[model samples]
Target chain A: MSQPDPLADFFAADAAPAVDRGFRMAVMEQVARRRLRVELALRSLATLLLFVGVALISPVLQRFAQLLGQDLSQVLLVMLAAGLVAYLGHFWLTRKPVLRLPHLRFF
Target chain B: MSTPPTDAALVAAARSGSDAAFARIVDRYQGPIRTFLRRLGPYTSDADDLAQETFLTGWTELRGLREPARLKSWLFSIAWRKAKGEARTMARNRQRDHDWQEIRPDCETPETERAIALHQALAQLPPDQRAAVSLCLGDGWTHADAAGVLDMPLGTVKSHVLRGRTRLVEILGVDS
Candidate 1:
């Protein structure tokens, strides 16, 4: 076997920087705290958007149903049920666990 | 002596809102993550940025990790994704100059010649084979560890290492 090249070893060793233990710990603590804040902020923004969207669309939907000689309350109920079903479907699709398929053998 | 707390314990604590525990996890794995990024061809500055992004993403998604004991591999997986993402972004932005210059940094005469030769040899190999050699030999990761970190099949990892080593020996004119 040939000897290991010193140049290769040197390049590998010098390629990465020296990490400061204390600074890294501090940065991690900062990131952890920031993550919690970001999560909470996203949740709040999503809730706000949901409320605003419903508020802005409810009256418009009701007026359109009434103009078409349809019962506004019944139309609203159907629409609400459809929206719930769609939302549930989307949630199920997104949150579903990744399933590993069975191995296939070919002779 | 009290046994040191395991990675799972530290990860669990972080999930439950312990900043110090999360910091410990970062301290434990940052070196390996940085080395991995460097091997992927990022210079020090970009490598540091990507490393920081990896940890940030890891911390945000830590709660969703099913197996806390596999934290090291999990962290490496995130780093790999981040590095690839950055590479794509750089390419899209027409920032090839920055990347190429970073990877092929200037060195003194003999060192520069060797570095260029090694870089050329590595570039000729397939990306997976290059990663296998850089991570396993350059970064000092075990074959099994590199396999787990790279999310490759163990057998595939072994083949990549063997093929890559043989190619490097031939390219560098190393005697058998």
Candidate 2:
């Protein structure tokens, strides 16, 4: 067994100091607010994407495609490459993420 | 009162959008998490706010946690980050206070007075060492667990605990 700290008894005695019920309620309220915000953001994004794809751009898209043929392909290739790199990087990061916390500095 | 559900069970329920399940998590962890934040006192001005932020992050990122069994360590990790993050916020919000260094714990008789003095001494350590001590000593976590929560190397955590523990013992002058 590892050598114990002399303060262990003190710590055990003090571990469960009183918690504020207000704090608990506040946390739950924030959780509800946050879930609502996320739902709203998703709905907004979905509407924006739907409008862009179906309502605003689809009618005039063929004219823009006609305007730049090979350049568009080059641009598409670059975009695809960037997306692939981002996906791979995210994959690499999520692997073995147990110890990867933000940098900590002591003053 | 009924025994609280295991963290893994609570986490699984919360991930399925059960607000009450997550609220139970908040109630279960609030004490130790707040105590850790308070004992790591220099880093956060409002332990309650930082603790709230930790649980809020937990609630929002429920699905991302791979192992719910490790939820205690994971939540502590979040609280550590929130504390560090709030330091930057506090630094921006107000003129930094340096008076904690000048605080001399009132030397008095009785075990309670000595305990208060010990806490004061603990608050006076460097923030990183205080964090290591708070997790390892105050909370009874292992050095490896402290290292994981604080994101320090295991060896570094051991040294921090050793130094912090020595300092606390010296300040308290407890017969060890």
Candidate 3:
């Protein structure tokens, strides 16, 4: 027969919390969130690098545009305006009122 | 009955980005890890948080674990480090006092008194000694296993366990 161990008995009284479904879900949720963050960060980095590369080559592109009798600056301005309009259109369609202009606020 | 997947298999799947496999690992070890943290002095209150952080660290660094067979001890080591780091900055003494007050009742039972005294005596021990006692005595871990998790020498772990057990018995006035 084994003798009663007081120390072990004391520890036994302080029972461990039951392993529940919630803990595993919580941990997996964290892992998913981490994965999402990493993906977002990488995408953002790629976008930034693309933008920097375009900016760096703008001078050479501008010279080529002049030889072709086209204004690169105007083309770039039109693209930027299109991008802004698309962004605002998205916000408006999504019902994000904060970005709506005064006349567009009602919609 | 079908046997559950082995640690190595689960670890390999988890490293391959399978959430289900990692969740299995979490389910398998959370109880032991939390209990171990609770035994480590003054960490009972935040053992859940420590356990969660340990899992999160394990998830992010899964690929770096050289030996998947050592996953259990690796997780415990991570948990031990998290508790130790938190213990240094948190006002744990105040929290321990508050816990005592919170558990106080109009009628004090012998079990309650013993529980309170046991935690108090545990709090009084040095952190390393307390960790040794908690892992080896409270959790029934082998001395070598405790030593690995604690990053302590085998001799040091044995010594800490012996001295820590002696101190606990002396303080609680209980027979070892």
Candidate 4:
């Protein structure tokens, strides 16, 4: 008896109609847009956190100045700016070389 | 000299907020993703929905991937899970029907008919066995690759293929 070619038959039977490239492009575009929105949202949240942190701390420093009798606001502003610079430096360092990683060899 | 970026390159770019890089990933894997979904028994309409969800989940979770070279397997693993979940939901909704007509195609050449029969025989096997056979025969995945994709032990995957192939040969009335 002949050995039937199951794999050949399977491929022939499963050959679907060609997909519309335009439809595929549209789907990719939708995904891209969604990713963009997510990144934007993350950046916006980071900015908001930075602003809120500074805003809340500024008033506290001003109140402390009344008790200490020193120009604590100027000192606080410089410290805040310096801290922001350090944070930016850390972000830059972490963001560098964001692409290279070891490939998984699962074969 | 900077070499042209590969798919992994594009994926990294996407992870770091590059829209174009993300689009590249979507473009590259869409066909394979769609084919995988189709084989999992989803109708074309529902296949599209599941495909979208698969890519979306992959995009959101790409950062967790330790090895970018295994991207195809990773994507397939996600697609497999999504398809299985959908199948379970579908089975619950249509519990009364023993025979699922979705397994048959409208147009059938003699070759196509035999292929459908083979698929039907395959569907009768357990999910892991069916998956091992499909990945090996349909997707051209090696036994080890199929094992990784299915999260099964290599020996388990080999057994599934051996048993699944034996059953397929029997149902197709082919001599080994």
**Each candidate's interface RMSD:** 9.2, 6.8, 7.7, 6.2
- lDDT accuracy of residue A71 in candidate 4: 75
**Residue pairs of candidate 4 with colliding backbone atoms:** none
Task: Tell me the lDDT of model 2 at B124.
Answer: 63
Best by lDDT: 3
Best by DockQ: 3
Which tens-of-lDDT digit does each residue in A6-54 have in candidate 4? 5556655664444556646666666767756766777677779989998
- Model 4 alpha-carbon drift over 4 Å, by segment: A1-4, A15-23, A36-51, A54-107, B1-5, B93-119, B174-176
- List, residue by residue over A1-107, the lDDT tens digit for candidate 3: 98787787677666565586887788888887887787777777777998999999999988877776647668877999998888888878986744532221100
> What local distance difference test score does each model get?
0.72, 0.77, 0.80, 0.72
Q: How much is the lDDT of residue A63 in candidate 3?
A: 86
Error of 3 at A34 (Å): 2.0
Candidate 3, which segments miss by more than 4 Å at Cα? Answer: A1-4, A54-107, B90-102, B105-117
Q: Please state the error at residue A30 of candidate 4 in Å.
A: 4.2
Q: What is the TM-score of chain A in candidate 4?
A: 0.41
Least accurate 10 contiguous residues by lDDT in model 4 chain B = B93-102
Candidate 3 has a DockQ of: 0.23
- What are the clashing pairs of model 1? none
